[model samples]
Target: MSKSDFGLFGLGVMGKSLSRNLAQKGFKISLFNRHVDEVEVDVAKNFKAEYQELKNALAFDNVEEFVASLASPRKIMLMVNAGKTIDIVIDNLLPYLSENDIIIDGGNSNYKKTKERFDYLQTKGIQFIGTGVSGGEEGALKGPSIMPSGTKEAYNNVSQFLETIAARDKNNLPCCTYIGPEGSGQFIKMVHNGIEYVEMQLLAEVATILKHKGKNPNEIAETLDSFKDDANSYLLEITADIFRKKEGDSWLVNLILDKAGNKGTGNWATITSAELGVPNTLIASALFSRYISFYKEHRVQFHKEYIKKSVSRLNLADDDLLKAYQFVRIINHYQGFKLIQEASEKFNWNLNLSEIARIWTNGCIIRSSLMEELVSIFKETNTILIHSKISKMIIDCKPSIKRVVSDCVLSDVTTPALSEALQFFNGITTQHSSANIIQAQRDYFGAHKYQRIDDASGKFYHTNWV
Candidate 1:
């Protein structure tokens, strides 16, 4: 038979699913996994047994054989863990790869590391593409949102396949695009994950608020279902399902541990935001909330020590809660986009914000009705907050958000995501804040200069007090 069209390394869940998906799309695929131990070897054997029935699918135990089986100017996608595993795969594949052969890193890798690898591989005439594949296990088997970034020439070799296997929106547009050179794909994916964190936390807070008001899981699920028609989102939809799920005699959600676990992407977003000097307060609060949850014992003891009897529940309207949710969702999306905008300029990525919004409308966890509006709005305006339409919406919704936050506070329930979002909104909208006093105090103590409102904007004045 003819050589396989492309190759996939690392026969893990993602790698296997992608191989099958590609094969079903009529592209032949050669598969291999590193011989790390008996478990890995057994996984590869099982993969070969499962797909050997398909005429277009091939599997090999040897890395060299896998690379050699691919067509000329070989294209191989690696689904291994990020960091050192990526480097190891490249090192092992180099001996078998020739000029113009391509390697794609389809993992949650750091963009900086991707750039370093791209540069390092170029020295040996091997093309490197740092691509991000989103949409969990099921999406991998069917379709996913694909983000690829590398040299334009390298992208051309894989663009067709990437687009073919990517999920499509209602308009049937593929949820895949060439992001830009030097790790732009990974950077965009990082922002996607960051937005996801904030969204999840926001939903959890809403659920907690409902539960505190004597709403059972089913009641909460029904209430969440009402938002499906308006604020329809994958996250929201699944949250409803989670509430309705039963385990033994109790709700599955309640049975699950309170502590949330993360795999570092959320932390990466917070770190990158600080490094970029972007105020991503909502995302930061979401990460901190998870860290706080880990202190289960301490929280339990604190709750026992601070017990108060006969605390009354604050009465809140569902409309107000819904409006508050919408407002905070918009804020979270705005923060992610702002980070993307700043990173694009800082890294010279030349990202298309509108296209990014369009591609995110499907497949990804953050996919939502909001993305559709964002695509149109981004095309017409550079800064979303400054847009008259969006500005008016924020102004109209602020009262509802404030009311919701007030209720949460009075009820002694923590709504960090909502509170931080409100804080962000207040900070940006305020024309004159308490910062004037801060500037004066700074000047009074450390001789830091203070900008005078009466003077030119950049003119600074220092005062001495004895």
Candidate 2:
């Protein structure tokens, strides 16, 4: 074989699954792990096509040997941690890599870090790609979608193989594609995670409310399962099954900690959004949700002292609650999309927001059937939400949205992330001015620091009545 279309540099959960997946696709696969025996017996038993797959091309004790073993323009996908580990992997592999070799960082890497790595490697004619892969271990093992961004040359060398391995989106586009130049793939992935946070939080709030109102989680799941077409997302589809599960009086998710932990991608999303002057309150909300989750000890104190004020009657019937919950999730989705749309514009991402939806449709964590609608909208409009059919539908459904948001606020049912995110989205969309004036007043009187574009900087200015 030509020592092409086959190489991976990690044997962890994702790497192991992906390597086997590649072999399953009839690729001339060459597997490598730092640990020699890590993939030996496993591949022998599971990957039947690899009796000699690694015999001539097997594990390498070091990068020096692995690169020498491969043909020119070697393609190596790295499935490792970010930060220092990436540096270490790069340093070790650089000696063996010739010019034009491709190194992909497939972990949940910060786009800035990927950009830095890409820039550094490019000077040596080495190509570094920041590829975002989703579908988890199973996705990796069978066919996961891949978001790759780097030099077009690098993509040219790899597209055939990538297409062969990726899951297909609608219109038969490869689940894998070049997102954009430089860090866009990773940047997009970061935003994807951030949105995921909001969606999860909104769903969590619904589950909490359902349980509090004496409805079984299974019943909640059953109701969600009934939704079809664009209304159903992969997460909701899975959650439906989860809700139907019963262990005594609670679901398994109920037993899990409410606080979410992150490896800093969402943090990166929030930071980048700030730097680009893009508002990413949904992503920011996700990060805050994680922070709030960390207050386990503080929660105990709060439950004793603060929860007394969480009183309200939400005696809506299960059917009505289900209707409201689905509508809220739609609001949540649109709001997240609105944040994405606004951020892309403000950051000059010039990004195809609808195409972004298409990319995430099958491979990433946020993939859902609703993206089909979004993708169709993008095909017809240059302007993003203002004139899309979906936007029209959302307008028509504004009554439900308003009712749900108002009900949540009036009853104090504690949908802080979803409700506030919706309010933020709605305010921006309809040009809500009261809050902006209020904020200006607070800043003008309190810190006295925000700048007005129409006025000069450095010196402060304010008015009580003007």
lDDT per model vs. reference: 0.89, 0.70
Tell me the tens digit of each residue's lDDT in model 2 across 148-190. 8887789888788777778778777878877777776777777
Q: Give the C-alpha lDDT of model 2.
A: 0.70
The count of residue-pair clashes in candidate 2 stands at 2
Pairs clashing in candidate 2? 218-244, 259-293
Clashes of each: 0, 2
- Candidate 2 lDDT score at position 422: 56
Task: State how far residue 113 of model 2 sits from its true place (Å).
Answer: 1.3
**lDDT of candidate 1 over 394-422, digit per residue (tens):** 88888999999998888788999999999
TM-score of 1: 0.96
